[model samples]
Target: MALLQNLPYVPDTVRGRTVGRSFQAVFLMVLVSVLLVGAFGLRLFQLQVVEGDRNRQLADTNRIRLVPKRPARGTIFDRNGKILAGSRLSHTVSIWPIALPRDKWPMVINRLSKVLNVPPDEIQKRLEQAGYESIESITIARGISPAQATALAEYTNELPGVRLEAEAVRNYPNGDLAAHVIGYTGELTDEQLKARREQGYRLGDVVGQMGAESAFESTLHGTWGGQQVEVDSAGRIISILGDKPAIAGKDIQLTIDIELQRAAEAALGNREGAIVAIDPRSGAVLAMASWPTYDPNIFTTRITEAQWRQLQGADHPFLNRSLQAFPPASTFKIVTTSAAIESGKYDPGTVLPTYPYIQVGGIQFGDWNRAGFGPLSFPGAMAWSSDTFFYQVAMRIGGPTLIEMTRRYGFGRKTGIELGAEESAGLVPDEAWKQKNLDEDWVIGDSINMSIGQGFMQATPLQVANMFAVPANNGYRVTPHLLKDNEEHRNWKESLELSDATIDVLHQGLRRVITGGTGQSLNVPHLPPLSGKSGTAEAPPGLSHAWFGAYAPMEKPEVVVVAFAEHSGGGGGKVAAPMVLKVLEAYFKADQNAAAAAP
Candidate 1:
C-alpha cells in the first residue's frame, strides 16, 4: 500500500491506458525470454551429443603417444659360424614434440646434452631437420649406456615426453679383417630418408651404406613395431593400450673365410695392395682383403669429423682394390693368347719373327724384352711375354674379335656379386668406343697395345682372376658372390666356346709361365705345379702396379688367387706372387689341420 501511494494518482481513462500498456510490455518481455531459453537448450544438446566424440578424440590425442620398439639387428657370420659382425643390446632416447612443453624445450635440450655428450644446438638442429610430426617421437640420442639411460629414467618426471628404448646396434668382432667386403651401417641421409620414408624408415633408422651390408639391406631390415600408451599432461605413462613385438632381422652367412681373410690381410701387411681368392668351381669369393682397412665398429655410432677426415686422406683406405681396374700388363696376354687359339688363325706351334720392336699405324712399340726372343712359337711367346708375337696375334684376330672374347668372359660389366656399388666394370675399349670417348680415330697401334693389355684396355684384379678362371674351368664362368648361398644369383654361366685344343694350348702356355718363364718364381716344390701369369703395369712416377693371378695344382684348379700391389715397383712374380703364395700356404695348412683333426 505504501509503494502504491508513492506513485502519482491517475483518473479512470489514464489508469486503464497505463495498465493495458504495462500488460503488453510484460507479455513481449516474457515471449523474448522463452525464445532465448529454447535456443540455449538446443545448442547445449547439439554440443553434448552430436559433437561429443570428436571433441573427446582431440582431447585424447593430446595425451596419447606411440613409441617405437626397435628389434635386434641381423648378425653377420663367416660360413664357419665365426662372428664377423654382430649386434649389442643398447638404448636410444627419444622425445615427442607435441607432448613436450614449448617453454621448457631449451631446458630439456640443455639437460639432455650433458647426458648424451651431444651439443644442445646439434639436438635442436636434428629436430628442425626432421620436421617434427605431432604423433612421432624424434630421437634425441642413440647408443646410450645403461648408466645414461638410468640417469634419464631417474628424472623422467622432470624430463617430460622423453623415453629410453632398448635397441640392437651393429658391432664388429673382427675389427678390420674383411672391412671392405663386410662394409658398415650408418644413419640414413636426408635424401635417403625422403626416398625410404614410405617404406617405414623413420628419422633415426640406420641403413647399410656399402658392400654386402648394402646389397642385402632389404632382406636384413626387419619390420618395426611400437606401443601405444596413454599419458597425462606431464607425459607419465598411465597404461599401454596396444603393443606389437618387433621382428628381428634375418641373420646373414657369408662365403668369406675369416682365416683366409686374416692371412691375406697379414700378407698385405701395411702395404697399399689387395688380395682376392675365389673357389673356381663355385665362383664364391673366399677372401677379399684391401689393405689399410677401417673398423666397421666405428660406424655404429656417430663418425667423428677427425676420423672421417683420416679415412678420406691420401691412402684411400676405402678403395677395394680387388674390384678396381688397372692395366693388366703381361697378365693381359692371356686374353690375346686365348683369342689367338680360339680364332684358329694361329696354332700353339705357329712361329713369329723374333723382333725387338714392332711398327704399326706409323708408331713403333717396343717389346718387354729389348733383345726379344727371336722367332718364338705361340707357347714361347706367352711364356716369355713376347709383345711382338702378341702384336701380330692382335692384328690377326682384330679388335672386334678380342672385344667379343672379353665380353664372353664377363668384362666391361659388373660381376653381379653380393657386394653392391663397390665394383668397377673394367673398360673394354674398341674403335667405336675410342672414337666416341677420345674423339679420335682408332689405329692399328691401339689393337697392338691392347693385345699386350695396354692402350685403353682396363681390367680389375677380380676380372683378371676370372680371366684365368675361365680357361681353368673349361670356358664356363660363374657369377662371383660373397654370400654363402646367395639366392639372388641366377646361377648363370656364360659359355666361352673355347675348343679343347685351345684350352690345351692355353694350359701349356700358363704351365710354361711357372716352369721357365716370367712367373717361374711361383713354381714351389711342395705345391703341385702352380700355373699363372705375372703383370708389371707402368702407371708413371710411382713404380708399376705389380699383379699376379693363378690357380693351384695344374692338374685341377680348385681355387684362383689374384694379387695387386699398387705403385709397388717390381714384377708380379717378385712382388704380388709371394702374397698369393702366402695365402695358398695358409689355405693348405688350414685344410691339413682340419683333415688331421678329423676322426
Candidate 2:
C-alpha cells in the first residue's frame, strides 16, 4: 500500500471515494424495492379478503338475471270429451339484445331479417323496443312454423343474440262454434297485470278477457316458472344456473254437447239472434248460440289493431245475445200463468174474456186474431197468447205479485251462468224502478204491456228457457253452469221454493200452446208430446222479435229450449218456433244416436 501510494497517492484516494459511493447507491435501491413490495402485498390483501364478497355481488348484479317462463294453459272439452278449446305447441322468435355486439346492430338486423323473412326495419323496431325495456327479451315473430324454428335453431350459433323459444298458444278447433261461451284471450292490460302481479303475471302475459275464460282464469292459468342465468358484459349468456319448471294447468270439462252446439248454430243460419237450450234435470247448458258470430281463433294469437277493431263493430258479434234481454214476447205468458195459479186466485180452468180489441190505460190493445174469440180458458190464454186475456189476469195478480213471480223464475236478473261478465241482468220494471230510471210514474199501460211481455219488462233467452225449466224440472230451480262438476249448482238444486201445483198449471198451459196454439205446427204427435209457448213482440217500429220457449218429452222433460230472433218481420210461430223445433229434433236425434252407439 505504501509503494502504491508513493506511485499515485491522489489517484488511489479518488478511487476509494468512488467505491464507497457505489455501495451507498446499491443499499438505497434495495430499501426502495422492499417498500414497493410491501405496498403491493397490502393492496392485494385488501381486494382478496376485505371486499371480495361485495365485488362478487356487484359482478353478479351486472350479469345474473331471472327470466319468466309462461306455463301451458288448460284444455277445454265438451260433454262427450270432444276438444273445444286447447293449447297448441308454438314457437317464438326472440332476441336477447344485450348479447349482441354493441356496434354491430345494423349487420345483426340485416341478417336476422333475412332469416326471419321480416323487414329489416321491423327487426330494428323490435330491437329498439327491447332496448327500451332494458333486460326484457323482445319477440321478433310468433307462431313460428316448425321448419322456420328448426332453421333458426341451426343458425343460432352465428346469431348469438337470437333465440328460439317454445311457447303454448291457445287454439279453438271449432272455429266460431261456441265462440260466446268459450270467449277469448288477449294481452294483459295494466289493470289486469297489477291485479295478478303477485301471482307471477308480468307485463307481457296473456290473460282471459271474457266468457268462460274470464270466469275460470284461476283454474286455467297455472303457476309460471323462471330460470336464473348468468351473462357476460354484453349480455351473452354464460350459463343457466338454476330453473323452476313450469306446471301445466288442469284440463276443464264443460257441460256442452258439441253436436247440439253445432245444430243450434246451424239453426240460426247466421241470423241476428240467440238460442239457448238446457238439460232441465241438471241445469247443464246443452247448447248456447248467438248469431253473426265471430271466430274466437282470431283472438287466440296476438291480434292486430285492425283485426281487433273489426271485432268491435256495430253488429256486436262478441256479445252473447243468449244472456241479453229484450221483451219476452208471448214467452212471458208462462210467468203470468204460473203466478196467477200460485196466488190461488185463479185456476188453470179459469175463464178469461178473449177480445178482438180492448181499451185500457188510454191505450188500445188488440189480439193477434182480429176477429173476437169469446171467453177462453186460462190454459188456452197462453196457448192463444191473447193479449187482452193476459191484461185482465195481470190486473188481478197486480204489479208486485207479478214482479215476485218473474224474479222467482230467474227474470230481471242474471241466470248465474258460468259465462261471467257476458251475462246481463235484464230489467223487470216496477213502479219504483220506473220512477227512478225513467223519471216517470208507472201507469196502467205499463202493467198492461208487462202482462203481455211488453213495455219496460225485459228477459234473457236464458231466463225464458229457465222460466219454463222450473216447470219442466218439477218446480226445482238450479243455478245454470257450464262446468261438469258445478258444486254450487248441484248443492243449490236441493233447496227450491216453488209450488208443485203452480208448476202443473204451467205445464197445462204450455202444453195447450203446442197442441193447439202458436207452436202447434212444430208439435210431433209421435215424439213424446212436446209442450211450448210462442211469442211475437213489437220491435224497431215495423219489425218484431220472435220467441219460443219449449220443453221436450213432456212427461219428464229432459231439455228446455228457447229460441229468439231479433228484428225479424215474421211471428214467433213462424220464425223462433221452427228454429226451436230444429234444435229439439237435433238434440233428440243425438241422444238416440248415442244410445244406439253405446253398445
Candidate 3:
C-alpha cells in the first residue's frame, strides 16, 4: 500500500478519459465477433436446407457398386446331336485393386501365395501391373483345388480385396477333331472389346476366335443380364435386390456328320490336302476336312507362345484349303465340256483330231499320258482325260463362251455356304485378266492352256466338287451348303437345263473312268458302281498335284467326294482316287451295317 501511494500523484481527469477510450474499443471488438458468428450460422443453415439432398445423392453415387453380367455362350453340336463345344463352371480368385491396402499388399500376396498355391512374386507383379481399380486381378493357380478354394475363402478376411468367383470357361470335348470348322474362343482383346462394347462384350469377355464359332458369334453369344445388389459401406455385397437371369445362347446344329468327318480325317492319313464331300441332292457338305489341324482345346485357355508358334510354323494347318482356291487342273474339264455342249459347238458323238503334243500359236500342250488317239468320240476322250480333246473343244467354244458358262455354273465364285472366310471370285483369266496380271496379250496358246485347266484357271476343292455335282444332278447347279436349313431350299431341285445328251455322254465317260480307265482301281469289288474323274495338274517342272472328283452309286447318286493331294507326283487316279475309294467304302459299309441292324 505504501509503494502504490508513492508511485504517482493523482490525475483524475486524464484517467477518466483513458478509461472511456478503452471501453469503446472493447465494445467494437465484441460487435464484430457477434456479426461473424451470425454469418457462419446462416451459411450452415442454407447448406442444410437447400443442397442437403443433392449432396447426399452425390455421396450415395460414390458408394453404389456395380457387378459384371456374364452371359452363357451358346452350345455347338454336330448333326447327330454330338456336343462339339460347351461351357463349364470354374472358380477363379480375383482382386479388386482399389480396395487393396497399399502398405499391406505384400502381406496379402504372401498369404494368398501360401494358401492358394500361387507364387508370391506372381501375385505381387499382377497387383502392381493391374492399374485400374475396377480391373480384377487374374492370379488363378493353374487350376484351383477344392480344398485350396475353401482355404482361400476362409482366409479372405486376412487377404483383403481378394475374392473367389464362379465364371464359365469354354471347353471342347472332341479336342482337335473338326477344329477347323468348330473353332475356339478366348478372352476379347482391347480392339475387339472396343468394337463389340455395345454388343454386350466386356473387357474380360470371351468370344469366338475362328470357324463357325466366329461366323455365328452374334447369334451364338447370348444376351447378358444383371442383378441389382445391395452392399455395405465397405462395398461388399450384402444381398441381391433383383436379378435378370441371363439367357443361354441358341444351340447350333451343324450339318456335318462327325462319323463321316472322322472317317475322312483318318483316310487322309497324314497328308497335306483337303477333302470336301457334299450331299448332291441337298447341297449340304457332309465333310470338310483339312489336315495338320490343331486342338481347339488349347485355345479355350490362354494359348502359350510356344503352342502358337508351333501352329504357325506348321504347313499352314489353319488354312481352309477346301474353301481356298487351287488350280482346278483336269477337274475343270467338266466345266469346259459343259460349256462346249451348251454352246452347241460340240456333241457327245463329235470326233476331234488328236495329237501327242499340239503347238497352238506358240505353246506346246500335251495330254496326261503324252499319248494320242488318232480320232475319238467325246465319251472316249473324257474316259481317257484326253487333253487334246478338251483343247479342241474349248477352242471351238472360244474363251468368252467358256467363261460365261463356267460363271453360270458357279465357278470362280463363292458357293454361298454358311461358313465364314469364303473365297471370292477366282481367276477365270480371259483377255482382260491376262492383260492385267500377266501383262501379256491373249492368244490361241492362252486358250489352249486355259482349256487344259492350266494358265489362269483356279478353283477351290468345293468348286471342283460342285463342278462334278452339276452333271450328276442332271445339269442343275445347286449352291453347296454346310447347313441343312437355309432359305433357298426351293432352288435345289431347279434344273440348270444342261443338254440331256451331253449329260448322258459325260456320265458314261465318268463311269468308264472308274470301271476301266485311270480310276479303274477305285471301283468297288462287291458294291454298286461309282462314277468319277481323275485329274493330274502339272506343277513346277517335274511336280504335279493329284485330284479326284467323284460321286458314288452311279445309278442313284448320294454323295459326291473331291480330294486333292499337293505335290503328290502322281495322277489323280493313283493318289486321290484310292483315298476316295477307302472313304466311300467306309461310308457304304457303315450305311449297310446300319440298315441291317434296323428292326
Candidate 4:
C-alpha cells in the first residue's frame, strides 16, 4: 500500500481496464503453450511408432550390403574322362561405389590401374557399366593373375572400395582342340538378362554362346548363391549376416574321343576344310573339327573388338564346317545307286555304257576324264565313280525316285544333331521345289546332274558321314549326337528297312573303290580293309571341292569318317582321301596301342 501511494495515481475505470488486459494476455499465453506442447507430443509419437521399421531399415542400409557368389559352371569331359572345358580358381577385382565416392573414383581407379596393369579408361568403363549410384558392388576385372592380385591386395589401404575375390572361371585345357564342339562363354547382354531373369541370370553372368555348350546350357548353368554382409564405412566386410552356398553345375560327359579329335584336327591343319568321324553302331560323334579355329580360352575373358573381328574373319573360323552343307559330288552316287537298285532298274551284275560325256537337252555335260573307261558294270561304275553311268541311271530311275532315295539317306534336312542352329537343312530339289524357289521348270538335265550329287545338291560333312554310316551299320539311320547316353536320344536310331542284297552290293562296291579305284591310296598296311567313295565337285570362281566318305573293315564297320576340302585344287583322291587316311591311321593306331597296353 505504501509503494502504491508513492506511484502515479490513476482513475478507477483505467485501472480496471489495465488489470483486465493483463489477465487476458496471461490466459492467451497459457493456451498457446498448451497447443505447442500437444503438437510436439504428436510429432514424437509419429516418429517413434508410425515410421519405426522404415527408419530402422534406412539406418541399416548405410552399413549393410549384399555380396554375390558366382556358381561354378559344369565341367565338360570326353568319353574317356579327359577334361575338355572345365573351371579353375581365379581372382577378380570388384569395387563398391558407396565406400569410394564419386569424387574419389579418379584417384582410386588410377592407383588400381597401376597395380592391375589395366588402362584407366577400361576401369572407368567398368564403373560406368556398373553405375555410380548403385548400392551393389561391380566386377571391374576377372581372372587376374596371382601377381596382379597380390599387388592390388598390398595397395588396398591406398585404394578404397576395392577387393579381390576368389572364384571359378571357365578354362579350356586343350586350347584350340575341339574348339567348335566345346564352343565359348561370355557375359550376358542386357537383353539376355531381361529374357533370362526367371532363370536367375544376372547382369555379369557368363553363358554358353555356341556348340554343345549352348545346347546343354540348362544342364551346365548352376543356381547362384549370395551372402548378406555388414560392412564398415570403408566398404570392408565386418561380419556375414547371411550366407547361401553356391550350387555347382553338374558335369557333362560327351561322346567325343579326345584322341580321335586331336587326330581329326591335326589332319585338317591350316586347310579351309572339315573332318567328321562317327561311331556307326551308336551314332556318337567321335570327332568333329573345322579349320581356322580359335582358342576358346581366348573367349574366357573380355574379348577385344579387334579379336572378335579376327575370330569372325573372312574364312568364318567360327563356322562348324562339319555341320555346313556343300555339294556331295560323286559321294552322292551312293544314293543314286540305291535308287537304281530299289527301283528294279539295275542290279550288281547289270552293265552300262559309261562314256566320257552325255548329251542332255542339246547341252554336252562332260565327265572329269575326257577319255573315260569304255564300259563299266554296276560295281565297276561305282569303283571308278562313273558320272556318266550314274547320269544314265538317274535318267532311267527318274527325278522323283532319286529324290526319294536322297531323302532316305537323310539329305535335304538337318541331321538333328546335338549341335543346334548351325546345322543346315540342305536343299533337295524336286519339280515343285524348283518351281517354287528357283522359278524354273525341272528338266532331264537336273536329274542327270543330281545323279552325280551336283547341280544345286548340297550336304554337310556331317550328313555325308551319316550317309556312309547307313551302309556301314547295316542300313540303320542313326541321329548324330555328342552327349554320352543322353536320355532324349535313347531312340535316336531307326531301321531303313533295306534288303540284305542292297547292303551287300553297297559294301562290295565301296570295298572295290578302296582296293582298285580312286581311293586305293588308303589301302595302306597300317589300316584294316576300308571302303569309301571319292568326290570332286565343280565350284565356279574357285578350284574343285574334294570330298571322301569312308568306313573301316569291309565285313564289320565300327567307324565312319568324312573329309571335305572346300575349294581345294585337286581330286578327292588326292586332297580329301589322304585326310581321311590320316584320321583312320590315327584311330586304328590308338586302338592298337590301347589293346597292347591292356595287361
Worst 10 residues of 1 by lDDT: 486-495
| CA lDDT of each prediction against the hidden true structure | 0.83, 0.81, 0.77, 0.87
lDDT of 1: 0.83
Model 4 over residues 1-599: C-alpha lDDT tens digits? 89988999789999789989999999999999999999999888887799888888866877888788888899999989999999988888888766666888999999998877778997887687777766677777788878898888888789888878897889999999999999988878768878998888866788998887888988998888888899888788899999999898889999999999999999998999999999888789999989978898886666778898898789998988998889899999888888888888777678878777999879988777876677887778879998888889988889999999899988999998978588988889899999999899999999999999999898999999999998999899988999997635487678888877777788888998998999999988778999999999998889999999899876788899999999998899999999999999999998899999999
Q: Model 2 Cα RMSD, Å?
A: 5.7
**TM-scores, in order shown?**
0.90, 0.86, 0.87, 0.91
lDDT, residue 402, candidate 3? 81
- CA RMSD (A), model 1: 3.8
- Give lDDT tens digits, candidate 1, residues 110-133: 888887788899888776765544
Model 2: per-residue lDDT, tens digit, 360-468? 7577788788765688877777778888888888787788888888887777778778775778889989989988898998777777788889988888888788877
Ten-residue stretch with the least lDDT total in model 3: 134-143
Which rank order by TM-score, best down to worst? 4, 1, 3, 2
Per-prediction backbone clash count: 1, 0, 0, 0
lDDT of 2 at 38: 92
Candidate 1 clashing pairs, residues 3+ apart or interchain: 354-375
Residue runs of model 2 more than 4 Å from their true location after superposition: 1-54, 61-65, 97-141, 145-160, 230-239, 486-489, 494-498
Model 3 misplacement above 4 A: 1-58, 61-63, 92-162, 233-235, 422-424, 486-490
